[model samples]
Target: MDQNSEVRLEDAGDGAYEIVGTRSGDRLGRVALTGERVTVEVVPAARRRGVATAALREVSRLTLRDRERLELLIPWDNPIALRVALAAGYTREGIRRGTPELLVYSRLASDSGEPAPRLLPDLPGGELSDGVITLRPLGEGDVDFYTELHSVPDVVATSVPAEPKPADEIRRRCSRAATQWLTGSRADLVIVDTATGLPAGEIDLYYQEPPLAQAMIGYSTLPAYRKRGLTTRAAQLLALWVFAETDIVRLVAGALPTNIGSQRVLEKAGFTREAYQRQRLPGPDGGRLDDVQYVLLAGDLLAQASGAGTSHA
Candidate 1:
C-alpha cells in the first residue's frame, strides 16, 4: 500500500479497536483496517511482546467474519515479520521490488472464531505535591514577577555570569520560560507572599531526563524583598509542594562557590551540599569558576518538615 493508503480499519465497523496483551498496559499494539487490508502499528515501550501478533489475529478474525479479503503489506527487508507472519497463518503472496520494496502477505479467515483482546487503563500522572508551596501551573501574570526578580542587582551578582541583564532581556527570558511551561519541559510558579498578596519571586522545576524522574530547581528574589527570609520561606514551601505534587524524586541546584548567600538560602530550605566541581561554571565578570552542587531528596524534605514541627513548640 502507498503512504496515502488510508489503511485505517475504523470505517469497517465500530470506528476503532485495540488489543492489549500485557499486564503493564504496555506490551500493547493496534491494527487499523482500511477497506480490506490491515495496517499494524506498535506502541513504544510495549514492543517485542506478542502485541503485534495478537492484534493481527484479531484483525484477521474481523476481516474473515465480515467476508472481506485480508491483505497486509510488509517491508521487504523486515526480518521480524518473516518469523511472525508464518507463525500467525500468513502466507507470502508475492514481492514488489520497486523504489520502495514491498512484501505482501495474505491469510484466510475461515472459522472467524478467535477471541478478542482486552484493553488497559491509562497511565496515571503519579504523585502530586506535598502541599507546602503548591506547585501549580504557570500563567501569563507570572511574567511580571519573574522579570522583576531576575533584574535584581544581588540576583545578577550571584548568577553564573555576573552581569545584570536589561529589562528587555529579562522579559525575553520570561517569555522563554512561558514557552517551556506550555511545552511541559518545565514547571514554573510565581512565589506569592501569602501574607502580603504580592509576588516575591519565582520558582522553576525542570525535568532533566535519562534517569526517569529527576529535576533541577531554580529561584530568584526581588532586591527589596531579600534578607527578610522570604527566599528561604518560599523555597521551603516550594520544596514541600514539589514532593507532594510531582513525580520527581531528586531536585538539584548549582551555585558559585563564593556565593555564600545563595548557599545559605539552599541550606535553610533543607538542601544538602552534595559535591563541588572546579571551574565547572562561568564567572559573571568573565572566565571560568568553581561551583558547588546541592541536592534535596523528597525524603530529606519530609524529614525536615517533621523535625521543624517537633521543634516549633
Candidate 2:
C-alpha cells in the first residue's frame, strides 16, 4: 500500500495487527503490540515502510493519555525497535544493565507541542555520500572487508585498533554498529568508491562524553585507493555532516608523528594542526606513542565552504 493510505488499529481482541490495506483491507504482514513495556514487531514483508513507526506513535498517544508516562525498554541490540521508538517521540533516558543490556526510552504526556529530541540521531537513509564516494554504517557483512583492511601493513602501522583485529572481534564490532550509533558511542562507516561501487576504505567519528560537543576523526584507505585523495574527501564529507547535523563545536584528529601522509589528509580536509602530544596514543607494543593533533571548528568549516577563509588549513 502507498504511504498515504489511512490505516487504523482494529480490535482483534488485543493490540495485535495484520498489516492490512486501508481501502479494501487486503493484508501485507502482521504487527503486534503486546502488554506493559510496549514492545512492537512487524513481519519482514511489511517492515521499514512506516508501519512500525505508525504503530508506536498510536500506541504511545493512547497509552500516555491513560497514564502519566509511557516507557520502552528495548534490547540494546534491537536497532529497528530503537528507531521506531525515537521516531514516535520517545526520549532515550539511559540503559538498564543486566545479562542483556536494555536501552530505556520514555515519553511523557507533558512532553507536548514540540517533537522529542534525540541525543544521538539516526543516520538519514542509512548512509551519507558525496558524488565520488559513499559512507554506510558497518555491518556484519563487513567482517571480511575489515579483516583485509587491517591486514594491510601500512594501514596497520598508521591507524588505531593499531594492529589487526581478530575476525571474531571485527564481526562483533560490525554487528554492534547500530547499537553504538543509538547509544552515541561511535559511528564506524565503510567507505565506498562511487564509480566501481566497491568498498574503498573506512572512516569513523568518535563522540565524546556527555554534552557531545567534541568528536574525533579516524580513517584509512585501502592500498588500491591510496594516492587518489579518497580519504581526504571522505573526511571532509564526515566533517560537513557532523557540523550540519550536530551541536559539536570541535572535531579533532591525530596522526603518528612520522605519518606525514595522514597529517596531510586531515589538513586538506580543513583541519588545522593544534599541537603534538607526547605519548598520547597507545602503542602496538606495551609502550605509548606520540601524536600530532589537529583541530577543526564548526566556523572553520563554514569559512572554507563560503570561500572566505584562506586555502591553508
Candidate 3:
C-alpha cells in the first residue's frame, strides 16, 4: 500500500481537516486540519516514533500550501504533546482561558518568523551550595517533591492550615504555578540538599501590583531541612535576583505571630517588621490568628548589599 494513499486527508469544514492512518487493519492515528491549523492525535501504543510528525508534515504541506499561519492546541499538562508541537515548529502563544487544561501554539508560515516566548529565565549566578544546600528554579517536574515535602507530619503541623491535600490537588496547584511563571507573573526557586539533590524547600515572589512594581515573597522549608538556615539563604538570593532583574520596588511578607522561623528568615533578608494585624489570619486548626507584616524596600536591599544599613526587624 502506498504510504500517502494509506492516509486519507478529508476537508472538515470550519478549519477542520481529518487524516486517517491505518496499519494492519488497526487505526494508527487521526489528524484534524482546519484552516492552516492541524491537530494530530495518535494511538498511545504507537507514540514516541515519527508517526505523528509524518502525518503533520503532510498536513502542513497541504494547508500552508496557501496560508501563512498555523496553530495547534494541546492540554497544558501534557508535556509529551507540548514537545511534539514545539518540535513541529509551533511556538506557544499564551494559554486560552475557560479551557481549563489547554495551551495554544502557533507559528508563522514564513521562515523569518519570531521565536516562541521564553518559558523560563537563565539560572542566576550565586553561591548555590555553601557545602550543604543548593538553589535553583522551581520547575513543573518538581510537583512530586513539593507535594511530598509539604505532606510530612511536621511540615503540616507548622504550615498549611488544612489537612494534607490529595495528590490531584497538589498537581493542580503545581499546574497553576507553572502557568503563572510562564505568564511572567511569579518567580519561584527551590532549595536543594547537596547530598540528595531533592527539593528541600521553596521561595517564591509574586507581583502584588504590576503598575506599582510591588511584590510579595513567600518561603517554606520541609521539616527535615529545617534548622540549617536554608530558608534564610534561599530568600536572600531570590530577593537579590528580583531587585537586580525586575523593576520591583517593595517586597511584602506576612507571618503568623507565632511563626518565629519564618519571621527570622524575613529579618535575615533585610525586611523590617511593619505591623501586627489582630486576628488577621486563619489558624492551622481553623480559628483566627494574629499576623505580623514585614516590608522590604528596594533601597533597603541595596543599602544592606552595599554594607551601609541595618535592618530594623
Candidate No. with top lDDT:
2
Could you give candidate 1's per-residue lDDT for residues 125-222 as a string of tens digits? 41222332233334544666666666677777666577767776555455454434422356666665555657766666777662567777777767
Predictions in order: lDDT: 0.61, 0.78, 0.69
Where in model 3 is the C-alpha error above 4 Å?
Answer: 1-74, 78-100, 103-120, 125-132, 140-144, 157-161, 174-179, 284-286, 308-313
lDDT of 3 by residue, 32-95 (tens): 7566556788888768875666566566666665788788877756656665665556676776
Pairs of residues at least 3 apart in sequence or in different chains that clash in candidate 2:
none
| TM-score of every candidate | 0.52, 0.80, 0.62
lDDT of 2 by residue, 59-133 (tens): 667666777777788875678777778777888788889977688988888876134555456667878887788
- Cα-based lDDT at residue 18, candidate 2: 55
Q: Which parts of model 2 are misplaced by more than 4 Å?
A: 1-5, 10-36, 66-68, 98-100, 113-115, 118-130, 157-161, 209-212, 305-313
lDDT of model number 3: 0.69
Stretches off by above 4 angstroms in model 1 are 1-138, 166-169, 176-179, 210-212, 308-313
lDDT of 1: 0.61
> Which wins on TM-score, candidate 2 or candidate 3?
2
